[model samples]
Target: MTQSKTWSQRFESALHPAIARFNASIGFDIELIEYDLTGSVAHAKMLAKTGIITPEEGDRLVEGLEQIRQEYREGKFVPGIDAEDVHFAVERRLTELVGDVGKKLHTARSRNDQVGTDTRLYLRDRICRIREKLRDFQGILLDLAESHIETLIPGYTHLQRAQPVSLAHHLLAYFEMAQRDWERLGEIYQRVNISPLGSGALAGTTFPIDRRYTAELLGFGGVYANSLDGVSDRDFAVEFLAAASLIMVHLSRLSEEMILWASEEFGFIRLTDSCATGSSIMPQKKNPDVPELVRGKTGRVFG
Candidate 1:
């Protein structure tokens, strides 16, 4: 086998042992493959434009990166353990594809900034998805509200029936909360859309590379001005985690009500068998296991 082929085989062999112990992100970070390729393409273009690399080399790098991207999309790409992160895995693959030209794609970039940029890009997309899911959840609540608009349900305070309320009104309350959650996610996405690609590690690159050109290429709103802030700032992740926590809280509240409604003492709602489970010994008991489990999982979500 050639040197590259040997390297590939060795890398593949090393992957399993590390992944089995550390929980390989090849499954998760693999999602960033497209963004990684895009970043490399933009960097190559910028390098050529800035006279750091020859236009021919940049074109070759871009073509190679595209080919690597297609390989990933076609399920032919395999990441390995020796590749420390998604950035390394991608660069390694690109090098394998185009020889020395692939190695130049990392010019004026660092894994710190590369990973940060990839993460921001990832979060931007995920936040949008989460917002869509929130909207769907809200729609479910709204449909429930409209259907039960006049249905009177006992409103609880401290787990006790404190007063009577329209079931619609109760459900709509969650709708409002979910809408705010959606808004929060949108707001956070704007902040996460800034590009960190030009920030090499903790400090900005000295290269005459145009950050704006790369930012525009990647569809980023703008490049981060402060290099240290760009690389170290995980506020976007924290914001996403916060939004997720709030949504989980809202879901937990809804799950709690479902659990209560499904209880024999409450007798307010009959959960579908699809959403419940029968007790092993208590053959008559149709337990609200789903909502209870969802509620139980909320604690882990918060933590």
Candidate 2:
């Protein structure tokens, strides 16, 4: 029978490096370490406050975590390839720094709920920033709308000219789309801020831990009522992705319009050199690459 190896232990048959690279998330999810460390600090404090561990141990764990955070901040945290993912990589580092007491940090939690909490923490900030940027983009569109209020453009339906319209009306329609994207992101933030820290493995822990206090420490608006749902639920992520897909759709539509407007046939607009590029073989052509890139990225986002 094969026994499970600890963090530093090698597999009985020696796991291959090629497979390790294929399964590793440390490349991208290491970005998750900031939230992961924040969650651990909250967990450690709650453990001490609730008598799950001695106050001295909790203090050590917090200090160790802060050191790890510092390492990450200073570009000094090097992840081990054998460590499965960010959670394991972090726990491995913590155990190394603070000795056995660092092992107790996972007593009342599971990587399931830990990741859920970390993703919420990470996405809460991300959604807010995306919304703010979208608002700024809307502001830019509004400026364009204001300047183009008196400018005339032909509106299209089914690739045919349908009616004459002010350029402002055409641009303002996109701002309305941006407004919806902004509001959708705001709603997503509220749902993503609930804490999932106290849900251990699949069931609630029997440690008399204070879920509410942990939630408060993490700045979560509330605690999950059902531990199973807390650990298993990813509905917030799905919603955010859906909303993001919609925003990308709006962006791609706008990009398609920009690509057409800047075309020689339409001759409706000219892109600035900073955003425009020229084809390698064509000396006279200034390509609408920025808008084209937005359109290209939309496919990857949807996928």
Candidate 3:
């Protein structure tokens, strides 16, 4: 069956199969559906508030968008390859639900700003979750440190034993790394909370819409001062990557320590049965695969 094309009117010919396959992003951008719908709902309300669209029309648009969200939650709203990306997919579904009024939801916005807004919302939520996970990890580290305060282990320099140290002090080093990572995420969140919805394309829209109102509705700190900067800036994403790389570096270091300590030569720690695996041929060999995997995968995050 021929899939319906969302961008056919602007072009004279059907896109080549290879070009279409390469251009389609629904495979991964489906993750942004929920965030796109949320931004749409906020935009619709802003349109109504500013008299760009009738309040009744805005209500219909919001109702249709919410219905699509419900359909997604129930596993019924599936977007196929024809939709291109999450923004187009939601608009296509909204029009099906509310007819022409659903089409009015995009009056004061561009897909440039739409996608920018969606990405910021998604990253903001994810940063909060990551921070929480780091908090929990710090708690675990603290508990272990408290229990091992009296336990002594050999401190090493150049992989050779140099002096005695409390295991609690060693664990606290990781706690400090995690604390710094948590603070970095908090700083990144502030940058991610700015709204870009009114910056249509790379320029401000002609519509007399309220950007600040939409930002407030979406729980953002403020609207972007420069429209071009608002839609094009990805510094927050790069900052997040830098901070995540540091976090992985710390994790890889800790994994290296655990791997060394668990070995017979070090004899400072033991690999529990649930946390280790037996070798294929060696009858008595228990492998520290968990830490080994962590150490190996750290390079992926750095890249």
Point to the candidate with the largest lDDT: 3
What are the clashing pairs of model 3? Answer: none
Candidate 2, 124-167: lDDT as tens digits: 98998998899899999999999989999999999799999999
TM-score of every prediction relative to native: 0.87, 0.93, 0.95
lDDT of 3 by residue, 229-249 (tens): 999989988898899889889
What lDDT does the true structure give each of the candidates? 0.83, 0.90, 0.91
Better by TM-score, candidate 3 or 1: 3
After superposition, candidate 3 runs with Cα above 4 Å error:
1-5
lDDT tens readout by residue for model 1, 125-149 = 7887888888888889888988998
- Candidate 1 vs candidate 3, lDDT winner: 3
What's the CA error at residue 52 for candidate 2, in Å? 1.2
| Best TM-score among the predictions, by candidate number | 3
Comparing 2 and 3 by TM-score, which wins?
3
Candidate 2, which segments miss by more than 4 Å at Cα?
1-22
Clashes of each: 0, 0, 0
